[model samples]
Target: MAWEQVQKALKDHLGDSIYNLWIDPLECVSYRADEVRLACPDRFYRAHLDRNHLATVQQIVTELSGNDCKVILCDKETAILPAAQPKGQLRLPHIPERKSVVRALHPRYTFDAFMLGESNLLAQSACKSMINGDDTVGSCLYINSSTGLGKSHLTHAVAHALLADSPQTRLRYVTAQQFASEMVRSIQSRSMDTFKSVYHDHCDFLLVEDIHSLQGKKKTQEEMNELLDALIKSGKRVILTANNAPRDLKGIDNEFRSRMGAGLVTTIQAPDLATRYRIVEHKAVQSGLNLEEDVISYISQQIQGDVRRIESALLSLSAKATLAGGAVEMDMVRDVVAEIVGLSTNLTTTLIGEIISREFNVSYKDLQSRSRKKVISFPRQVAMYLGRKHTEESLGEIGKVFNRNHATVLHAVKVVSELCRCDTSVRRQMEILDRKMAEM
Candidate 1:
């Protein structure tokens, strides 16, 4: 049960290969009467530890008759991870009194990294100005845009700017749903004081992404209202980003809606061809691809609509060409485009069969079969969502590909789309998968 004993057991059994592979990088995050905590430095570490190291540690504890043990891997970038002190302990540090330390800041998204133009210049300027004492003190700035138009980037940039002194600023950023869950935890633990202080009074700024996540949680909205009032009264600024503005947060109270709208509100419409081309150029530079003007325009026009989709297309195309030790050309780009938008990737029958199988979690024969079950229904819809989310194909076209009616395809897309929006686990999984599909 002692810290030294745990360390010795791990060192004795885990050996250099497994220890370095699984345990060495983690910090002994905490230990209370019934639980011990471990913290890893990044997502890769957390994934490996959770998959491989967790069982070994649990077995060791069970052998020694230790208290019920659990391993929680915290994202070091977020407030989720506890900082370790020297001497095998972690401090339960309160969110600091000074408002300079914040998590939820994506270091890759500074003003310098954001691809800005007319669409986001004002919002970007406000973000850049905030750290320099140029506070945009409005009730809230409402930024709404179609997915992948840099709203998340701008939100993180603002948080990073405000927390110019990393250790001193105590900013708390979360989706509205996470805000709700944390509020419940605060109430149960009788630590609402720390929760409110961390989320409200201790921070000079609050940034909430995906305000739509708050659509149905009334009790959480009430808690947020209190936090909002305390923050505004204290002259702190709050930044909110969502798919829609305050007036559209379904099921929210009217007064709370007004409170959100008391400041500047802006909506970013979907990109035009010109904006999409600019995005493709920016993306080409980001990806180290020297795209010709014609190539950029070709991709921009083809991908259309969401800037994120266009960039994704471009990055994936360029990555594929580079990996094959070939130059990026119209032909290379055209092949990728055809497959995603049509049936033109030169995929061998075996590879094409493999992809279809993975997409729907059905064997090629099963997909060809006539089974009607929840398992198939689920992955079929997931494949439809992928076709809709990742490719520029028409619904009818996607239906033909899946050998289903257009209406059925549309229904699958709708159900999966809604699930991705409300279901966090599904949302994260699809995001990762969508990224992978584009790369392929």
Candidate 2:
């Protein structure tokens, strides 16, 4: 009952996502008035817990047990070892044999490592359903999103879970380009049957990434269509990811697109502000960085959309702190944020206008023109919106860059904000521009 109480307290304090990722997997070895023991999944999990969570566990245990209780955390293997083993005997943890994979899966890309948010909850849930053999999700799933939005992460997670749960599962994970190249090699060597046989007969689960690359390749498309047909007929599970939806993909045949869209089609949107905060916190803890709350909030606010940018910023922060005698201050964080977002000192309204003009294919001078043409006016509005976001300029100051008034700049920001909420295409373009600005 005390253990249950501790679990409830942890869930309440740390929130569901963090609790599920770290604490929920832990097994209770024993509990007593003065001592409690917990078993972690492995050395990696145990080390992380000891570094980040052990003190919290000890405090909670002491309060619940009404004594100065000591908490012992060890790997599952050590917890389950024979009681007769000699005292202080060294034992190496047993490691499972690695499963064969076409491309090595990242060890940290498993489902537990994925941060759930409003933008990606559906995609994550659907992947979990497919892996759990829930019939509602069907046998095929397609996830589409822009770069660095966790498309590959989810696919790798599915593969990792499958092989771990069912080691004998004949899984084939490859990119669309890799699949096309292998097919070409098979044809060149006059051994197409062997290639077909490998996917058709030997595979139980198939994962293909970046199906957008298969566009305009008719022969590859034909072979892929036939392969999908065979795999589906045999009730094999398949997952494919791309940067575009099936119907939106260019140069892809209708039948092949139909197959891709047959089961479930999900898209991952950019993380919202709250989700971005959680991501920043989670990454900082994982990297063993003792960043202050204000630092985390600042990074989350500045770095939008891409998860990779956050990682890069944190890594840079860590290096800088180490060089400066391990002190992280607000000024250091500001410099890191500016560097990651590609702002030299600050992002000027002029630079924002130029980037928008180039992206919208309108001349920079035209943006400052009085023309009401949709092409010219739309880009000007976007520039105004971005200027308000990336610079400390007032609305009037931002409007001066476009030869417009503060009222016009404010209206542009409002209109573009609403459009980003209602229109997927608009939101996607903004995400692209956001990335471009960060990389500039």
Q: What are the runs in model 2 whose C-alpha is more than 4 Å off? A: 1-100, 344-440
Worst 10 residues of 1 by lDDT: 345-354
Per-model clash counts, in order, read: 5, 0
What TM-score number comes out for model 1? 0.55
Per-residue CA lDDT of model 1 for 69-151, tens digit only, reads 66456655652444454594343555333323334466777777776655677777666555454555354566887787788
Candidate 2 residue pairs that clash = none
Each prediction's TM-score versus the true structure? 0.55, 0.58
Top candidate (TM-score) = 2
